[model samples]
Target: MSEIWFRTGEATVFASEGQATDAMPEVVIGSVKGPVGTAFASMLGQTVGHTRMFILRDCNQQVRPAAIMTSKATITNSAYVGLLGGVVQAALADAIVDAVANGVIPKDIVNDIAMIVTVWLDPRTAKDENLDQKELYKNNYEAMTTALTRAMNQEPTIDELIANRKTIRHYSLEGLDIE
Candidate 1:
């Protein structure tokens, strides 16, 4: 209904719910005629241990915005493949559709916009039978929605970044001092 406000967006969200089942999604959204589209089309050729695939909400239904998903880790194990292509995939697709429904991703550009999501699904989850599939789903869903919202809004705006620059420590540097 309104003028298109977002031409390109990208963000990464890490959601922690399950150990080894923490979800991290790095998302890029843009027009099909842009670079995101080029990467989306070209990623189809990657068929190593892990391959790229479309994000589907169900057996025959892909999400409206038309998204592709790739793995951050090389998927060598069949079990890991199943988890990624199954639960994680569904989580992401649902998140995208809900984003549209909730106005995080505008409904007007569903056809023109394409999403490329690079997901990290921990390898440990595949080997651990006790790990809950629901937890995995919830984790990814939270991550996907948060990532999409952040990207679409161009979040961590200049002021937000400037204010929090010194307060937030890089996750990787948990214990080391500034010295």
Candidate 2:
């Protein structure tokens, strides 16, 4: 089966394969159900080979679908099973979109997602509270490369540059032309 690593809080839709019908019936969030366990059985029923789904739970008052994992048999020519997994994943992602759009899921889930993205993009900040106490800095790959190139200016002497240099964590655009 195809391995779909979906964004958090997103759901996908899946349809049956090779039914040879006009209207393909779609099942949304077949991986995880609101009432719980219903989606599990449905996914198992849909699996042509082997599949596994994961449900992340918060002790009380919160039990939602977190992640889904599906596997295909090694000895079987089950390439179509990958297509099936993709369908299911898409349905799950759509379900997430619908839930968020309809406000079925709490508003904080959006904020949680944003926070997660922020943490991933800025791991240095996320690592420690004190880390942000210094002058806050965010450097992208291009920006960092530009800064390095500028730092290595055509100096008269390496010793002179070394003597004048300061060990600074942050980058500045002011000193690039100084030779």
Candidate 3:
């Protein structure tokens, strides 16, 4: 493969359907020309909870940037695994297809580029039977679209970051005393 450009982006979609279904995906978009690609190729090995797998548009096709997705959250229940591998995976894969079609990812480099997205999925999602499956799909779909779009566009420019630094804090730190 010939050397090509690289871009990275991260975005979170949360507090939508429910806390259990929030999606935070950090995407690395680049060719096998660098470290990110190396990481992508190597992520197939599974640990206990994080089962790395290629996101497929169907049984035969993997979404381009040739995306790979895995959850960081430790999953203890079989039900959680079902949701993570089922609806959530389908949602994220669809978003990736849209990204390529929408020009958020260059169509030409679909073969050359690869993506490895670190996804954060709260494992409690399976405990509640009444949780809306459609909402969960929508939440993750939005997250992947936002992340890929921002990656290709290089969003939140340095100026934006500096301007928001004082007002915007990590959500977990919302009630903290730090300044």
Candidate 4:
């Protein structure tokens, strides 16, 4: 039974010592934001849909969570997201009739997708259960204001937000909301 393992380069692994145990890199898992999923889905829809439109076969799938985690860290590209969101919105606008007619997406699936996308865009709408009136109103107001602002102002891009954002003397250092 060997207690240590040597490497060609200067790196060595010792089984008896705890160095090898702690040598493994720490992997922090995170979620993916922005329109990566939408893009992936669109591509999948085009390619996979052509081959297996609605087959019930279980295909082996491998997802890279690390890739998703890294992408989520820097997914502040609102312009890219807006592009994908526009596509999703456009598809959703007529998905019901068109998908059903074309047999691309099922009606039930379309409805579910609409609900999911609606939830992703405005989470408040997805809450079916009742809550405190004040909190409910707050969430509703936030969601409505966000939607209205985006619609009226053309959904400011992340670059625009970064460029336009300015800090007040007192608020800037304190990280407080100026407006």
The lDDT per prediction is 0.82, 0.29, 0.81, 0.26
Tell me the lDDT of model 3 at 15: 52
TM-score winner: 3
lDDT of 4 by residue, 49-104 (tens): 12211111122321111111111112234542432233222322232233245453
TM-score for model 3? 0.90
User: Cα deviation of 9 in candidate 2 (Å)?
Assistant: 18
> What TM-score, to 2 decimals, does candidate 2 have?
0.26
**Candidate 1 residue-wise lDDT, 1-179, digit = tens:** 22333344443444354457788888888877777777778887777876688999888999978899989898878899899999999999999999999999889888887888889888788888688888789888988888888888887688998898899877888898872
Candidate 4: which stretches are off by over 4 Å? 1-131, 157-163, 168-179
Candidate 4: deviation at residue 140, Å? 1.5
Most accurate candidate by lDDT: 1
Across 61-112, the per-residue lDDT of candidate 2 in tens digits comes to 1223333334323213333333323332343334334444556444344322
Model 1 TM-score (2 dp): 0.90
CA displacement after TM-score superposition, residue 57 of candidate 1 (Å): 0.7
**lDDT per residue (tens digit) for residues 35-56 in model 3:** 7788888887888877888897
